[model samples]
Target: MRSTLRSSPQSTPAFSLIEVLIGVLILALGLLGLAAVFPVVVRQQRTAADQTQGLIVARNAEAYLRGHTLTTTRSVPNASVPGGGLLAPSDPIPEQNRRGLDILRYQGVTATNPYSTWSFNAANPDRPGPWEIPTYSLVYTNPDRGNMLVAATNQTAGVQFAQRDRLWPAAYSSVDTRVDDNKYANEPRYIWDVATRRVDPGTPSNVGDDGIQFAVFVRRIDSSIRVSRRDLINDPNDPLRLSRPTRDLRLADVLTGDRLGLGGVVTLQRAEHRVAVAVTNNSNSPVPTLNGEGEYAMPMRMQIEAIDDPDGQGLSRFLLPSSATDIQRRLLREPGQKFVDNLGNIYTVVKATFDKNPPNTSNPPEVQPENERRSILVSPAASANAAALAASGDLQVVFTPQVPAAVHVFTMEPR
Candidate 1:
């Protein structure tokens, strides 16, 4: 064979070094373009999902409203109100937790929020101790002591005892809703008091409805009421029980600490006593009757809070609209509540007022955002009460988007 320089195929240059480099560059550019489009695709998907959730929530709210007849929405007329409502007395026990003052005060001004007012024990005729309470007061009896009546001294419904005669003609007389600041160790969560501009703001004025029902006339034993003690110089029940303040616990000394640290110092070992209680308006009676008309009956008010979810994930601020007032806005922006997600997604709330005047006669009970906050009345008479426990008519309790109209709003974060 002629020894020609038969170059093997592998020896030939398949591509120059520049060509290889260019190929890599093109591939990299294509990958970069894909990466850029990835974020856009994600953002669009997220937006669609969020908006769908918003509509879903709105319809859920609408269905809920429709299901409630004019009756079920009525609450106690004087719930959480000062100088309002009635109280149903227990059957009467002699050895009640009548430990405090004869001129005793319960969940009155000292312990209650602005929505609820406090009063002294109201009694006139026979003084049980030294003085009978003069104003309306809430009393708690020790269940261990046989559910005895620990109330203002001896009296029937007379001039001094005539609190129940005040009639509640209208079905829904009052809007029983109030706001309460969140607290830990008696310290308020935030400092800025937009509603009242309270300087200390330990417990300032409440703003929007907390979206929970409160009782006007609270009967039966409320398990939440109990007693707790704090260290006074030393733990009262210490091993040696060598508490200096406990031995000399005069009211003056215990209350003011006798200029000692025990004034504010209390035992942290809390003990629940049926006799000891911190009363709230929830335990008071708003509609008391000489007859048993309002027995075990508590007035309940509608709140614009989050709705119940089958999945247990509560509704976010889905109904909160841009038209919310300054106080309403602050209420919606509760601390630590996540409104937006990490992926530039947000969730919002859109709610309608139970008292909106001109109903959205159009489609799907759609009230204007402004009208959603207007206080309305529910005066269809208590005759309709509990009659429509189950929903009926074209008005159904829908939760999904099968309903054509929107009653709520949900929004995601803008990209």
Candidate 2:
């Protein structure tokens, strides 16, 4: 029997290989874009959180100053300063020695030199008897340290003894283990300083209506090494245990030679006991330092070097000391990095650039490109004639001894 060939049923249309690949490519691109955005979102969140915390700390400081008034006076031994002065049994009590006083009194309006030149303020007042030029004082806090704020010595205040009189979160007790624990070893601390100025020097008739202004500065402390504020208070020798030069240390010597090497936050004990984080992790991979015997050399940690900005941007450049090993040249480029001049003028790092392997352009290779100096541009751009200032023996912008995570300048009136 002749049976007609049955036609195959029409097959359902399916995606071709090329079309599937194209779809996958589109999906992958979208996923990659999301991956990139995640880190940015996380960073933004962290920054916002830090800013909120800073503002809170500042407000807290204002509350403390307004509520706690310093009335008692302390005597300083003249012999400790001015060397063998027959002047008085003790040095004259400093005017700023006291805090939380009414505006008229703190401003010294009745004194012979009303608005006496405060070293922290400008030499010449701008036309007013009372301008709020705040004098700063540093305070360190650690949650593990029994939630107390440790007041650091303020040589800027001129009356170091008065620091003890300032209001503290908790009363000092000889039996308190928390107070003593802060003296030994505590890593990862938070540092904030406060300064108060009389915003309104009330008239003699309305002296009670005066208002006080507070400026609070908060900095991030990324120190892995111990910071002993108590030692600074009590011990005469080896405070902070930073006597050992970090420049002498090798990769193997720090943090027990982690596989990541001496990267990330580095404790610059000699750099005013300030803690610093590396600009980037990629560049911090420790390069091996071989000894004469062809073995890995073990030395102390490398010390950071502060180089003047060749571009005349003030203290805007940094490098590793000549003794630096492979761990040198890690720039402190984190945004909002706060540095303070000797005069307590805070400078924030807005930008940073590091030439990992800059071209060496010297007749006989004067310096290696890898050793090129890095640049950091801070706000309040230093005078264009920074070199001239240095030559004139003026105070150049020096971020003495410490770099904190962030600096917040807050103007809070005492409530």
Candidate 3:
């Protein structure tokens, strides 16, 4: 009792069980909140990296363009090349000199053979129009093959860039190397394309003849997606016109499965969509009468459809599908994304519209579809070309690789 009395003050009470649990709960809640931010941080980092790389690539392209001097005279197409007629011999779009800016015209526009030329947009008169193919003489003469050339195997069917549209970060051949020691091999952070158009008036007074003002369009390369190109057939619903698939193309099923859907028919009932393609040399070309493979580069050659706007806004909308096969679901989610169509039309995605979900339940589960209808609105509305193609009786089943990617424009005087 004397010793207890000697203890001046009672010692502070120990923490109870409830206090410990509460402390743990608070810590866990904070950790969970922190964990949720990690993915967002990662995405932001990736986006920033992409943008940085894009700018660097664009600058490199500008340097390349500036280093090369433009040929003033008209270049005649060589008769030696079999498809020489389709190729542009010189720089079709002019710079300071108005005389050089001439549009190339061909006899016909076929599905298998889409033509490219210089196009003007009233909406943005200061910048250049869309790009289909680059000028021949300028790219061919350049010595930098490592960064400028796209692998021949990667070329889009029916549509070939002047030489190779893609500009790789590393050597083109090392894109998929198997060297164990070379961990960095084939891991390109970014790939890009370059197109040019005149900016200022073609006048030597403003910008010297040699110092012509030009706009360089540098677009990022996203993905190389392959889809089947069905033969153009008569639309039963509209006898006069060729058929556009009433239902969305079952891209994922056809690609991932063993057999392709039968008769190229758009079926309401979901079935096994597989096309077992057998090739001798592993050629990537579309198979004849089988699941033909058409490679489309994201933001470059990725296909997007023109949406029907009831309000007469002249908006070009991309129909986004809930299906996993529809690449739009993952890519092209942001506005201001730029892409050039096969018709040499450049479009900037504006905003995403409402997502239409499919029926969740049905009497027969097998009959129930998993995809929903989604639409993305784009600006500089589609020209009459899309409608004309759909109406054209010729093989209209051609897959237009509409590439929409990050684009950087540079205004510089070519040296």
Ranking by lDDT: 3, 2, 1
How close is each model in CA RMSD to the real structure? 22.6, 16.5, 18.7
Candidate 3's C-alpha lDDT?
0.35
- Candidate 2's C-alpha runs over 4 A off are 1-11, 62-335, 353-371, 383-405, 409-415
> What tens digits encode model 1's per-residue C-alpha lDDT throughout 167-265?
111111222122232111221100000000001111223311111111111111222322233334465444444534343222122111122242233
Name the lDDT value of residue 304 in candidate 2.
29
Candidate 2 lDDT over 1-415, as tens digits, reads: 9989765656657789999999999999999999999999998897786677665655555565444332111112221111000001011111211111111112222233332222222343221122222212222221111122212122112222221122122112122223243331222223344333333333333332333333354444323433323222122343433542222222111212111112232332222221121111112342222111111111112222343554654445433344433343232344465543322345666655553333444523324443354445566654434333333333222221123434533333322
Q: Please report the candidate that would top lDDT against the real structure.
A: 3
Which one is best on TM-score?
A: 3
Distance from true location, Cα of 371 in model 1, Å: 37
- In model 1, what lDDT does residue 285 have? 24
Instruction: Report the candidate with higher TM-score, 2 versus 3.
Output: 3
Local distance difference test, per candidate?
0.25, 0.33, 0.35
Model 1 local distance difference test score: 0.25
lDDT of 1 at 171: 12
